[model samples]
Target chain A: MLEKANDWSDTFYDKWKPIAMGFVNGAEKCLQCGKCTGQCPAAAVNPSYNPRKIIYDLVNGNIKRVLSSVELWQCFFCSGCFATCPVDINFPFFVFMLRLGAMSQGFGWEDVKQLEKYAEKDYLQDGITVSPEERNPYVIEERGDIADIRQKAGMPRQREVSDEAIAEINMISDLSGMTNFMKKIGGVELYDCSKCTPKIEEKCKSKELPKKVGNVKTHYRFYNYGVPIGGADNA
Target chain B: MHKLDKLSGIREEIVADIPIPEEIFYFQSCVASNKYPGIESCTLDVLNKLGVKPFVSEDQTCCGGFVTFANVAAPTASMPAVARNISLAEEEGLDICAVCNGCWTFLNEFGHFMNGNDEVKESVNMMLNMMGREYKGESNIFHIGAMLYKLKDRIAENVERPLEGLKFATHYGCHYLGGGKYGAIDDAQHPSFIQELVEIMGGENVDYTASGECCGTGFTQVINDKEKSLDHSQMKLESVRDEADPDFVIVLCPYCLSQLDRMQQQLDYRRDVKLDIPIIHITQLAGLALGLPKERLAFDAHIGGQDRFKKALNKIGIDY
Candidate 1:
C-alpha cells in the first residue's frame, strides 16, 4: 500500500530488468485476492510475507527494495499460492523465480555466508552421521521416527550434523558454479562441499537404516498388510 | 502378490481401428536412463502390445531439468528443444510421452513457454530455427502416466490376460505433477490416475498412502554425498514399502521403479528389512492385462514379478 512509484533507479533497473519486470507483470495480474498470502504457512506464523505486497514491489520496478526485504526468503515453495489463486497463477514458482532473480542480481542473500561454507569444502570421513546419544528433547519431539530409526539401525545416535561431514559438504559446494555466483553477487561464502570424501569412508562401517525416511518406507522383516501401518499416529 | 480387485475381468469392446501409433517418442530421463534399462524395455513392450509403435530419440538428451529447477538456463534452452520434438509428434500426428517424471514435466515447460511466455518462445524458436528445425508449440507432451490415464478405457478392454490377483501401490513422482503450469492433471500430493488404472486392469490398487513422495532417485546422491550414513536416499522407496503393504509396487517413472526395486537390495542389506516389493511400470501392467505374451510383457528384466505373474497367468484366459 505504499505510494505508487513508477520510477526505479537506473542501476537497479538495468541490473534486474528481466526479474523486476517479470515480478511486476506477475503481481499486477495477481488479483490482490490474498490466496497466496492466506495459504502461506509462513504467513500464518509471520504476517510479513504478504504475497500481495511482494508482488506489488516486484511489479513497480522496485527490484532493490523487494530483494532487500527479508520476507522474500521465507516462502516455503508449498504451492499454496497456486492452489488459492483464482487466475490459477503460480505465485510460488514466481517467488522462486524472483529469488533466483534477486540472487543473480546481487541483492538478496545477506546471510548466505553460512550457506557458502557447505558449497566450498569437502571432507571424506566414515562415521555414523551423529551419535544418537546426544539427542535432546527437541529430537524426541520433532523427529521421533528418525530417532527411533536411528536407534533401530544400531547406530550410535548423534543428531547434530557431524563436524567432519559439515566440513566435507563445504568442500563439495565450492567446486560448483553456484559457489562462485554466491561469492560474487549475494556475497555468500561459497564452500566446496563436493570434496568431503574421508567422512564417507569413515561411515562405510555399515549399520541398519531407518525403515522410513522421507516418503520411502523400507520394510525389513516382512510385508504384512493386515497389521496397522507404522507411524500412523504422526502429524 | 497377484490379487484381483474387480467383479469381472472382462474388457469392453472398442473400435479396432484407432490404429495404434508408431514413430512414438520416449522422453529420456536423467535418472532412469542413467540407472535402469530393464524398465525402459518394459515400457516399450507394453506400448507394443497395445499395437502402438515406439522410437527412442537417442539424440534426445536430458530434459534440461537439472538446470530448470535451479533456474540457471533461460527458458529458451528448454522450450525450443521441446517445441521441436513436439512438432515432430504433430508432424507424425502422434503423442509424445516420456516415462520419467522429470522429462514429462519438462514437456510442460515447452507448453507454457510457447503459450504463456512469448519472448522465451521466440528466443527458443530462433535457436531452433538456426538448427533448421521449426517449433510450432501445438503438440501435446505427456508423461507415460497421463497416457496410461488417457488409454484407461483401451487398457481395460485389452486385458486378454488380466493380472487377476495382484495388489500393488502407486508411486507418482513429483515432476509429473508440477511438470509445468499446464503439465499436470490431478493433485500432486495424492494422484489417483495410477490407482484407477490398477483397478481397471483387475488388479487391486493397495493403500500405499505416500504415493506422491519423491523416490530420491534424482539428485539424491549428489545432495547426500557428505553424509553417507544418513541413508537419505533410502527415503524414496522405504516409506512406500512400509506403508502401502502392497505385494508389489507400481511406478510410471522408471527412476522411481529403480529406486524402489534396486534399493530393495540396499534396504535388505543395510536395514535388514527384507522388503522385496517388485516395481512394475504401468505400461507393463497394461500389457499384462491386455494378454501380451509373458515374454512380451517384459517380465524377465523387471524385478520381483516372474513367480507372481506365473500364478496370475494360470488363472486367466491369456493370449500370450
Candidate 2:
C-alpha cells in the first residue's frame, strides 16, 4: 500500500479537494476496516469492485487511476456501505461525485449515454423521466392501458403538471447547466426503425434488441454470500 | 468523535416520538404515475381512510432524482430542481408525504444539502427566484411507509379486509433506509417496521436471509447493465423463494416494485427461475386492508405473479 503512493504529489490534496468534499470528513477518514466492502452489494457481486479500495486510492491521491477505472461505474449507489460505515462516510455521495469527475474527464460516456437520451427526450420535454408516451410504442400502449385502469378505478387519467410548472422545470434545467451538460455529452441520436430489418425493427420497437451500455460483469448467481451482517469485527 | 456525536443526536431525534400530521403535501413520482398508477391512487385512498388529507399539487414536477442517479447529470445540477419541488410544499405550509422512496430520499437529502451549504443554498434559491419560488428547507419530507408505520394502530382499526392466512416478505429498498444522511425513522440495519405493519394487517411476516439487500434497480443499471441488474434481483428473489414462499412481496418504492415485479418475468424467461411472487407497493396492501375494490388496486398493471395473487385473494374469499 505504501508503494502504491508513488504517484502522490504535494498538490494532490488541493487538486482533488472538490471530490474529497463529497465525503463526510474527506476520504482520509475511512478506517480501512473493510466493513464497507463487506456490506457493498456491488462488491459482493463483482470481486473487482471494492469500496474500501476506492477510498484507499482516493485517500492516497490516485485521482487519475480512480477516475479512469471501469470499477468507478459499477457502484449501484445503494448506500449500503454508508448505512454500515462506522464513521458514516456517505460512500454513495462520494461515488456519485467521483462519477461526475470521471465524466468531466471523458471516462464513462458509454455508460451514461442512454441516460442522456432519457434526460433529453423525457425529462426535457415532459418534466418527468419515465414518461411512457415518450418511449416506444409498446410502452405507450401499456401506459394507455394503465390510464384506462386508473379511469375505471375512479382516479385521474394521469398526474397533471401545469404548463407553468413544466416551463419552470425547463428553465431550471437550462439555468442549472443540465441542458448544457446534456449537449456537451453529445445529444442522443434518434434511432431510425426504417433502417433496420423487419425482425430487428420489431425488437427495436419493443426495446429488447438495442442492449444497454456498460461493461460491468456481475456474478450474482454463482456467489451466494449469505446476508452481509455488517461491522468491523464481522469483517 | 465530533461526527459520531452529531450523528447520535440526529438518531435520537429520529427515534423520538413525534405527532403524526393530519395534512401533508403529496409529492408525485414519475414512475408511479406513469407505470403503476395504482400505487398513486392507493396512496391517496389509504391516506383518506386514515383521516389524513393529502394535498395533491399540479404545480409540482418530477423529483429529478433519476437524472442524478442515472449519471445523466451531477447532484448540483439537480439541486435547483429539487429545491423548486420542495418549495411547493413549503408554500403550502405542510410537510411532504412521498409515496416513492426515490422522491422521499432525494427530497430529504437535497434539502439537507441546501441547509448545510449556505453558498449552494443561495445559488439554488437564486435559480428558484426565476419561478417566484424559494426553498427555505422548512417542510419535513416523510415516506408514506414511515407515515403508515406510525399509524399502525389507526390502520388496524380500519381493516375492512384483514390479510389473515397470507404471508408477506418485504423489500425496504435502498434509498429510504440506506441513502438517508440524517437518519431514518427505524434502525437501518435491523428494521421491523414493515413486519409490524404486516402483523397489524393480520398478515404473517416471512423472514429471508437477504432481506436487507438492494433490489438492484440502480436507476440506469436496469437499462444499461441488464444482466448484472437482473442478477441482483434474482439473488433476492431466489432467497425469498427458497427460504419462505410468501404469497406476495411488499415494497415502498415504485422503482423497486417495477424491478422486482418485471424482472421476475425476465428471470423466468432468461434463466428459467420460477419465483412467481407478486410484488405490491405498501400503499396497495394498505388499500386492500381499508376495503378498496380490486380495480382500485390495479394488480392488472403488474407484469408477473398476478395469477398467483388472484388465487391467494380467492383463498381469503375476496374476488380478484
lDDT of 2 by residue, B1-320 (tens): 01222332224366454457788899988888888888888988899889889899888888888888777766667888889888998998999988888898888888887898898899888888877999999888888887887788799899999989998988988888888845577677777677778888889888788888998776677787676787788888888889978998999899999889878877887889887789999999898788888888888778778678888889777788
Candidate 2, DockQ to 2 decimals? 0.38
User: Which candidate number has the best TM-score?
Assistant: 2
For candidate 1, write residues B112-190 as lDDT tens digits: 5577767756665665565455666666566676656666676776666656766778776545554343346555534
TM-score attained by model 1: 0.58
Model 1, position A205, has a per-residue lDDT of 17
Please provide, for model 2 over A1-235, each residue's C-alpha lDDT reduced to its tens digit, 9 standing for 90 to 100.
0122233454454455544333345567789999888877776565667788778877777666677676777788788888888887888877777776665555556567767877888777777788755333443444346678778878788667788988888897777677776776573333344566665443222332222123321111111123323221221
lDDT of each: 0.49, 0.75
Candidate number with greatest lDDT = 2
Candidate 1 residue lDDT tens string, A61-174: 656656545455545443446655777766755665665555444433332332332222211121111122322343244334333343333322322334533332233224
